[model samples]
Target: MALFAVLSGLSACGLPRSGPTKGEIRAGSVEEQGDTFIVPVTAQVARATAMVPPLGFTNGFLGAGVIGSDVIRPGDVLGLTIWENVDNGLLAGPGMNSTALQEMQVDGDGFIFVPYAGRIQAAGNTPEALRRIITEKLDAQTPDPQVTVARIAGDGATVSVMGGVGGQGVYPIERPTRTLSAMLAKAGGVIIEPEIAQIVVTRGHHTGRVWLKDLYSNPQFDVALRPGDVILVEKDQRNFTAIGATGAQNRVHFETQELSAIEAIAQVGGLSTNAADPTGVFVLRDEDPATANTVLGRTDLIGPQRVAYVLDLTEPSGLFNARDFMIRDGDTVYVTEAPYTRWQKLLGALTGAAGSANSLSKAAGN
Candidate 1:
């Protein structure tokens, strides 16, 4: 009776489990509360979910023409030099024939104060335009007045670049740095990996974003930048959690701009060979109402719904379908253990119990 009790206790001991079984997962779904949704990964589902809105520059950013780099702004500084034909003219003094006025900052109201020219609007006008205006004003006082205006450094036609960039500072918009990609290069390029790099451009109230690689691949994404534009180069924050019977379960970041389900699985070292159930691989995520309805082909669900997408690798077209399926951010990839694994554990326990019983019999005989 004691030997039988020992064998029964060993067989009934709780077995260690990597994750819930396939049948258990299906049974755990709550229809009323919308806790878990089990949906098979079909061709239609893959195509539907792949229709997520892509990020890029919109018409507001794309349609705007490139701004003139030579144009002056309110915060710009100017160096004015006045050369008069006569030796003691209005600007020049004594034996001096020319007068140099350096570091003339344009005021907030877009005006710069000159001795003879009074208050001149220098913000909208270029250096040459300012020269003509100053020459006209000083001509009455000094005969044949010659004026030259040179733009110095300031906040005019500039952008603020920060975050994950080689150089973080205010960059002036020059001829070579007029567009989004050009400005990124002006900032010494992105510091993070290009594949996972994302560029965000904020102009006024509007904001646009695109992958760093897309700037070259898609020319339309390289939109013209405006003054006061704030650009940020950052690494992709999108990542998924891998658990259950995978090679190494952890939070895996996206390696590329667009990650497919197969690629996501491979990044986590693929499914566990020994214990993984090929038909039980699941990708779990919280789907928005629209996406949830589309995937389940039902309209009763509302708000964010819990969805578990099952992928059967044993199918004939499983690999191809998985390659087409897209994995989103904050998703969980779970691979349930095979049914035979639990039975194997039970058999191993029974063998160990039998070995203990045989040892007791040997000791009694001795």
Candidate 2:
């Protein structure tokens, strides 16, 4: 009797209820629990759902390029300079010097006022192209004219870098810094944490995010930067908690925007060989309440829109199903302990206690 009591105590302390009861794992309802939906692990079940997480670098964000042909636009200021070997007329007229400097601003109609050239169109041409236009216009009047145009100041070629960057300021989107990666480097990369996986890029009315981990592997997302584009490099503050018979019972930080269930399981060190039940591995997720019924295919379910997915790793195809199942940011993985493990704890406890009690009894008798 003393041995039995000691064994029970040790069993309870060691095994400590690895997870929910078998019946609870097998039978649970959205209506009863107020939000838990039960999903079985199967290829069809995993295939039924479609999620476009911000993971791959080649998503819709790369489909489009910079705005308006990347051409010059209004609000741009250009500094125009002209050189003449011999002064003739217009730019370098009779009494003028060999060089003429003019500061021009692109007006609302995408035109710039050039001396003697009248309202010339500068908004849609490159600096070199604009120089040629001006030089050509003065070809007959001026003798051997050379012209240069520089973007002195403009909002159309500048981008704003904010959030998780060393230089959180506006930088020009010059030819060398026209791509996302170029701007990131010029801004001193991510300051808060370069390890972050997502960078939010907003251009005009459309806003999208990219996974930096994928970007490092894929160059497609290193898209050309556009005027008015805002780049935000934020920390990868997403995580999921792992508990129960799995190796670790702590919050696992996200390394990428999307994480496969199997990846998450592997990160937590897989299941505990001694205690984990191959069939009792589960993931708890809180789905959107409004679409849970239709999405989960359980009209009978009623509760708080939380769902649990049971993965039976015993089957050969179980790993495939888990691979396809994407884990959300805050899901929890639980691997219930096997029934035999519980029994072993009890038996071992009883054996040690029994030996101690037997020795005590012998000592008293002596």
- lDDT by residue for model 2 over 112-144, one digit each (tens)? 877666678988888878888888887777677
C-alpha RMSD values across all candidates: 4.7, 7.2
TM-score of 2: 0.61
Off by over 4 Å in 2: 1-21, 24-35, 50-147, 152-156, 161-169, 174-199, 203-206, 211-226, 233-238, 254-258, 289-291, 294-296, 299-304, 351-366
Q: Model-by-model lDDT, in order?
A: 0.86, 0.74
TM-score of each: 0.78, 0.61
Top of the candidates by TM-score? 1
Cα shift from native, residue 358, model 1 (Å): 8.5
lDDT of 1 by residue, 153-219 (tens): 5777788999999899887777778898888888888899988889999999989988888888998
What clash pairs does model 2 have?
A: 7-349, 7-350, 30-302, 31-302, 34-303, 34-304, 35-303, 35-304, 35-305
Off by over 4 Å in 1: 1-13, 30-34, 79-104, 112-121, 131-153, 347-366
RMSD of 2: 7.2
**Candidate 2: clashing residue pairs, number:** 9
Clashes of each: 0, 9
